[model samples]
Each structure stands twice: as C-alpha cells, then as structure tokens.
Target chain A: MAKSNKPIVWSLFAGGGMIAAFVLPAMIFITGLAVPMGLLLENALAYDRMLALVGNPIGKLVLFGVIFLSLWHAAHRLRMTLHDLGIRSGRVAMLACYGVAGLASIAAAVVLLSI
Target chain B: MGEVMDRRPYVREMPKSWWLGQRRYTFYMVRELTCLFIGAYALVILVGLFRLSQGPVAYGAFVDALQGPFAIAFHLLALVFALFHTVTWFGLTPKAMPLRLGEKTVPGTAIIVAHYAVWFVVSATLLLVARA
Candidate 1:
C-alpha cells in the first residue's frame, strides 16, 4: 500500500464531522427553535451576550474550530460526491474543492481574529 | 475467424435525477446535501461575524433579523440536515477507523457512545461557559 497526504485532510474532515454532528444541531435548535419560539429568555442570544461570547478567547477558538473544520469537511465530502456522481475530472475537482475550503478557512480566521 | 477485438469498457451515464430512483440513493443524496447546508451555515456565521465587526447596531439588527420566520425556517432545515449528516457520518466511524483494544477490536456501539459522550461534555461545557 502506498502512503499519501490524504490522511492529513481526511483526519481534519473526520474531526470536523464529529464536532459538527456533536455541536451544530443543538446550536441550530437553540437559536432556531428555542429562542424564536420564546422557550428561552428574550436576550438569550442578544447582541451583547453573543458579542461577549465571541469576544471570549475560548469562545473565539470554538467558533473558529467549528466553522473552519466544518468547511473542510463539507469541501472534501462535496469533492468525493462529485466523483461519486460520475464527474470524471478528479484533479480539477480536488483543486477546486480544496481551494474553496482553504479560502473559506482563511476568511473564518480573519473574521474571528478581528472580533 | 481470427479477429482483433476493440476493448472499451462501457461507462454508464449518470443522470441528474439518478438518486431519486432508490431509497438508498436518495439517502446518499441527502447525506451529500449536508455539505451544502453546513457550508451555508458557516457562511451565515461569517456574516454574523461581519455584522459584529460593524459594532452593536449592525450586530443587533442581525440578531433581530434572525428572529424572522425565514431565518428560523432555514435554521430548522439546516438543523435536520445536520442531524442526518451527523448520524450517517458517525455510523461510518467503525469502518472509517477501526480501533483495536488489546487483542480485540472495539465495537461499533462503543465508538458511537464515545462520540456522543464527548459531544455532550463539550456542549455542556460551552453552555456553562456562556451562562457564566
């Protein structure tokens, strides 16, 4: 068997998938359902509160981890999906898919750091 | 008769709606779509960050806008899609990276339980942090 650099990206993708699965739905539920439906206090997700959370060093890291890894996970999944769907151009797909994820990661880092 | 035969394997043309024909294929399609939903949610978070960068007024407006029906619906949809994605992706763990425990391999159920356990711990920690 030949070793390839894919393990690096694949590890990230796997980790991202785990975190996204673990954390995202509950997040979406709270913001989407609980807050909007009045299940929680009006200011549960208030701007000040959210800003404070994002402004927290730990919170900022968590936010970055969630967004950045999820992007890579989605990107790699989509690339494999394109191949699965019978798109024959492997090199092109890999380049485009990974390229987008990389750019998005940089953007996420910038946004988090600026905050 | 002796003849030289041309050898070309037939490639089946995949149609746009190929996934619609079967239950499993449809499931696969739905799983594939999680990437789109997750990717979109990440973008939404980025937008939230941008609004935050603009200061309280813009951030407040963004938070207020999130209460709208459309935003709620989109979030709900993304949540379901993310759930599906998580389950299916998690189910692949045993196969993706089989773990060995002493002389025996760890069971799939154990792997899943471990993932969920960590998930709960992390979520709980974050919630507590945010609350405090």
Candidate 2:
C-alpha cells in the first residue's frame, strides 16, 4: 500500500501479464519447433555445423529476451511463494522479497545483455 | 540483581479481527502457496537456459544431470506442483481478471475449462510436431 512497495507490486503485475502474453506463447512456439530442431542441432553439432544456427543475431535476441522476462517473472512470483510458505513475514520480510526479485531481474538482464 | 520478565504480551486477549478474518485469511494463504509452483517450474527452465548458453559441454552436462534417481524424484514432484499451480491459476483467473460484457459475467468454470482446453491443444500440438 505504501509508495515504496508500489514499484515491486506493479512489476509483479507487469511480469505476470508478460508471462501470460509472451512466455506461454513462446514456450509453445519453441517446444513445437524443438523436436525436429533439437535432433538436428544435436546431430549437426557433432560435425560442427550447427553452431551458426544458434549463434545468429535474431536467435540470440529472442532466446535472451525470453530467458530474461521469464526469469524475472519467476523471481517476483517466488517472493510471493516464500510468503505463502510462511518463510516471509513482517516489513523486513516484504523488503527482502522485493529486494531478491529486483536483484534476480537485474542478474537475468545482465545475462541477456552479455550472452 | 534480581528481575523476572515475561516475554509474552501482557494483554490476555485475541484481537476481534482474528476471529472475523481467519477463514478468508487462511484460504488466501493456501491459494498463494498453491500457485507457487508456476514460478518454481519457470526457474528450472531458466537454469536450463543458463546451462545451455554456457556451451555444448555445459548443456550436455545439464541434460545428463536430469538422468538419475534424484532427477526422477524431483521431476515427479515438479509435475505435481505444476499441475496444482495450473489448476488453481485457471480456477482463479476469472476472479483475478473478470471478463464482463455489459450485464453478463463470465463464469469461473468456463474460464477454467477454456484454460484446460487450450493447454490440451497446445500440448497435443507439440507432441504431434515432435513425432513428425
């Protein structure tokens, strides 16, 4: 309810919406493609031909974006999880929950940018 | 130096709000806990991606790690949690984000049924594609 808690709450809402919108659809897309591609990639990599497929600009961008948003969403949800599990309580606990989520999102963002 | 101290609050009473709030409060807590697996499973996928991005060897190692007694046990646990998370989420979706048109409110059961229908379609499509 307080102003400080607003960003984290809004982030959680946005993250949830993003997961529903992006991650679920993307998952269906990727998994639908994975069966054939996984086999090809697995076999081709043995002969050093598949690296280029995974190393493309568009592929990398999509992969990194999905990973970042999905994980960020997960981090926020997991904080709620800890609270539900009775591991978090009180003001300090609330801060810790959002703090961990923020850090996790930042870490995922860094991973996306770097890789 | 002699002193006796009672750590408990001296008031001999439970707040009135506790009695009024217990049922809803407990239900809310359980609902939140049940929904947690959605996040947990997502984290597992994230870890898999991290490993995959590391390189072929790391990816292979991650795959290999999934094959064993512990992996089997955890996978089952994950499946159970995932199912619980999905069902509860679908159950609550209508309440959380109601779809209304003028005077008509969509039923929660309808939302849940639609969710399962979509999940089944998506899952089957993937399976079919995999076999193809």
Per-residue alpha-carbon lDDT of model 1 for B1-132, expressed as tens digits?
889899999999778678889999988888987998887787788778888888989988887788899998899899889889878877888887789989998988899878778877866765554344
- Per-residue lDDT for B33 in model 1? 78
Model 1: lDDT of residue A12: 90
Q: Pick by lDDT: which candidate is best?
A: 1
For each candidate in turn, the TM-score is 0.83, 0.60
Over all chains combined, what TM-score does candidate 1 have?
0.83
Q: Model 1 chain A: which ten-residue window has the lowest total lDDT?
A: A34-43
Docking class of 2: incorrect
Error of 2 at A95 (Å): 4.6
User: Per model, how many backbone clashes are there?
Assistant: 0, 0
Candidate 2 residue-wise lDDT, A1-115, digit = tens: 6558668666655556434432353243333223224533233222122234345667556554554454455555656556555554656765765565466556554544444
Kindly list the per-residue Cα lDDT of model 1 for residues A43-72, writing each as its tens digit: 667777887888899989988898888888
Over the stretch B48-82, how does candidate 2's per-residue lDDT look in tens digits? 55665677788666656654556555555645544
lDDT against true structure, model 2: 0.52
Structural RMSD, model 2: 8.3
